[model samples]
Target: MSRRILVIDDEPGIRQALGQLLEYEGFEVKTASGGAEGISLYDSYRPQLVFLDVKMAGLDGLEVLKRLRQADPTATVVMISGHATIQTAVEATQLGAYDILEKPLDTDRVLVLLRNAFENRLLSEENARLRETIESRYEIVGRSFGIRALLERIDKVAATPARVLITGENGTGKELVARAIHRGSPRAKKPFVEVNCAAIPSELIESELFGHMKGSFTGAIADRPGRFEQADGGTLFLDEIGDMSASAQAKVLRVLQDGVVTRIGGSKPVQVDVRVLAATNKNLEDEIAAGRFREDLYYRLNVVPITVPALRERREDIPLLIVHFLQQLAARDGLPARGISEDALRRLQELEWQGNVRELRNTVERLVILASHATIGAPDVERLVGRRSAESPGLGGLLDIATFEEFKQAAERAYLLAKLRTFDWNVSETARALDMPRSNLYKKIERYALQRETVE
Candidate 1:
């Protein structure tokens, strides 16, 4: 598609000539005789670029430019004037006009100016879009005390190159915190690499961390750089660090101590400058006691510990998070944005978010996509949250009447049932979706005396 350009001038000859010239250059051009008509055309056409004559009959060019900026701050408007004065040009520039062109216009200069303006407009838009994406990606939109405190801590730590250890339960936005730290740090312009320690196999862990030379192992057909080398001069996030093998922990400690890495089957130890950020759900002290994690590595990585508060701990943020997610989902899917009722939001705040912020986001997305009503109400939240009515024989009612042990059993049963329903009663799907081993799910089903007939 051709780029659109709006041409505004009082003189018919100048408008016709410029319009013709722009059209010849493969631009879709529109012309207006005066400032009022130009503003109207600008709003209607939404042109990417505009050329406005300064000395007009009724409304002058500076007023038009100001109004244009009010309508679209990113709009690119070039001012053309036959009686060009320094004062007039400075005023136009101050009013956000893209450029000033003195008239008895040089057609060549006009074309060059137009091209520069167009390219600049494109670059500005692209940069704005990128910033928007980054903001959305790391947005922790909430007003709770816990969230505010967390943001304050982020502001403080982001200025330093400290080795940060983020401790949080699974699905509590630990990685998001890590990314925010990297983006805010001095080395934000450099790479931010991540390695999931729990996902890599024990045998390949060394190669994954420190790289491997060609023919070093069964899979090493070529030399490759690892996470530490990839994250040189930047920050490397090691997730689920407690699950890493003891041997890998020892190697990581060595790298931290020496600030260098030696790849498998490589003769030289390559020096690297990397800031380490590690995260885990397990207690590192307990792991050390069990001889599964290295104490030296733990101390090295724990230079600055940031514990992400669980969702339940910050219940006040639930409503804010819900609103943020709803707006995000609606924008992404091109659907009309909806709101949750105050009562519904309060109910959500009362619930225990075992899966934390991640779980809450998924719940909001599900509701936005699947809810029948435009405004989410308490009943809708209850249904989506898998909460049964107190009158029913499920956990909701059992909690009120049953003893502590009985309530615990009932709650466990209810949670399992909810997972089963979420996965359409496919045992494998339910187990995987719950991040539990299939055999364990089966054992729980048997121990709870869950009837196959009931599940079906």
Candidate 2:
């Protein structure tokens, strides 16, 4: 499809020349004699780019630009005028003009400017889409009292410049809470950088946090800015901060105290204005007692503490979370909408999710992909959770049995379930691997009530 270009100029000669030139270059061009007609055409045509004369007879170029921008904030308008002063150019720019072209315009310069302007617009649109996707991915979904209270705390903490320390069990969405605070803060438009302390090796964590100059370390090919510098005038999230080495902890403490970060191999301290939001699944108090984490750093980061409640603590929200996750997954994967029976949802709510919201979402996605029926039922839930239960350590491991028959039965059950999962419930393949007939394996699976999921 050809790009649409609109030329809004009072001079018929200039308009006709540009229109012909743009049309020859494969752009769909529209011309307007004055600002009033230009604005009307803009509303109707919705062109990708606009070239407007600054000094027009009717509505001035700046006024039209403002009106167009107010109608569509993403409008890309370039101002052109034969009598353009520095002050006039500045005013046009302040009114959101994309560029100011002096009149008797060079065709070469106009084409080059159009190319750059369109490229920038494309990049901006892509970034906006990505930002929306990220926000949706990290959306906090719940309506329970615990969730309400957490949201209230987030609102209060986000308005301040206090350092936040979010504590929660693994998979409880600590990072999501941290992002919510960052999005709510005054620095929402600025960078929101994150570092996972546990993922990086202890030896390289210092360089990762404080950066390093070229040749400072083995892999340092160029001077690099750390998370603090990258998140300048914004929010820096330190996830799994409890896993940070003691040396790194001390450096973090120093930065928190003075708002300055000195690179690993550099003497100069670079000043940074960053709000720190830290999260950890570990008990920092216990870590401090064990001499693992720094006491001063703990005190500094704990200025505004938040604890994300476990999934089981808010069972009422499980259904809502499930619906949210399922909808998001369906939309993202281009899959048909899936539903869960009331009994199935209730069964989910009854279980204790040690892994919390993350686990529930994963489970929902799995069901969406693997369920045979459009509406997931209790039996489906049972089969799915049963497979997971067999994998987890349970009372069978701790219980002592007196008879050989009891022990043999339990071992056989566990063995058969593991084999079935390995084969993904392919009866023939599992039977072959187990050195048994397919019929016998089926009988055993039925006797044990073992369920296998089918993945498409």
Candidate 3:
């Protein structure tokens, strides 16, 4: 569709000339003779770009620009004036004018400005669409009472500028909750910046959250806006907040309290209006009691606490989740849609999902990838879960696991050891067999304290 451009001027010749020029350039043109008519047309047409005469008869361009900006802050209005002054241009810019055009409009400059304005609008629209697509990917997908109640709470707080702290076990969709809130909020059109505190190194956490100036640190080559600045006027999701360093936590608390952030090696404190949503899989209260987390920071973040129920707590939604995952995965990967037998689904529900919804999705993906038939059966389910189950009596059996973390560690150790044995301790071959980077494999080996077993 052609972009709409509005020209508001009292002079008939200028209006006619500009209208003809814009129309010839393939823009949908709308011309108004007076300021009142221009404002009315703007209200009706909602043009993407507007060219208004600064010295109109009754209501001037400045007033119209102010009104347009009041209606839509992102409106693109370029002021055209025969007798232009620096003060007038500055005032127009302060009133949110896109640019100022000299009285005798240069055809090349007009075309270039129009092209740039439309390109910017297109980019902004594309960004909004991408954000929507991202939010859709993390849509909450259950109908249980727990999920329904959570959705209700989300609706209640989504429109407001309240801080939310989500708590749940790993893979229980804490980030999903945060994204849902952002998608439903008033600032939905703005950025949604996320930071994983646990994934980033402690030394760089400050820069990652609050940004840094050029030459701030050894590796700082250029000025960088941190997550907080990037998320200005929108939502900032801080995941794994419990893992943040003490210094970073204090800085985060200050930002939350004062709505301002100072970059590393910079003296200026930049103010940002951001809605913060934080998530953690660990119990922050316990961390505070253990002196690892600050109590004051906890209270600041836990304004409206939301605890996502574990998969076991909402088992009724397992079948629905299974079906959703199956269809979604099949569609995404261009695989034939697969079905899970009732017995298979039942077996799945009976097992504990220590990783919650994430574990379930991974299991479904594994089955779809490895299943021989279109319909997955109980035996297939058993074999997949059986390998990771603590009770299975084999190389993968982890019967001694006392906690979920221990269970995961034992499974990793067993799997790594078995793969290493299968490949005759060839690290490259074993890493290839496991489809992991060699460095990651080596790290896992070190983390699990894996050692070669002596032959009898």
The clash numbers for all candidates, in the given order, read: 0, 0, 0
List runs of model 1 lying over 4 Å from the truth. 1-124, 333-336, 388-456
* Best model number under TM-score: 2
At residue 139, candidate 2 shows an lDDT of 92
- Return the clash pairs for model 1, or none: none
lDDT of each: 0.83, 0.86, 0.86
Residues 1-456 of candidate 2 have per-residue lDDT tens digits of 238999999999999999998988889999999989999999999999999999899799999999999999999999999999999989988888999998898999999998998899889988998888889999999887668778888888898999998987789999999999999999999999999999999999999889998888788999998888999999999999999999999999999989999998898999999999999987687689889999989889988778787675577999999889888988777766899889988888876675778888888988888888999888888887753332333433313434676567656866887788788778999999978989999888755545443222
Off by over 4 Å in 2: 1-6, 12-33, 36-45, 102-116, 213-223, 333-337, 387-456
- Candidate number that wins on lDDT, 1 or 3: 3
Residue 61: error of model 1 in Å? 24
Please give, for residues 243-350, the per-residue lDDT of candidate 1 as tens digits.
Answer: 898888889999999999999999899999999999998767767888888888988998877777667556778888888888888876576688889988888777
How do all models score by TM-score? 0.63, 0.75, 0.61
The positional error of residue 312 in candidate 2, measured at the CA in angstroms, is 1.3
Q: How does model 3 fare in lDDT? A: 0.86
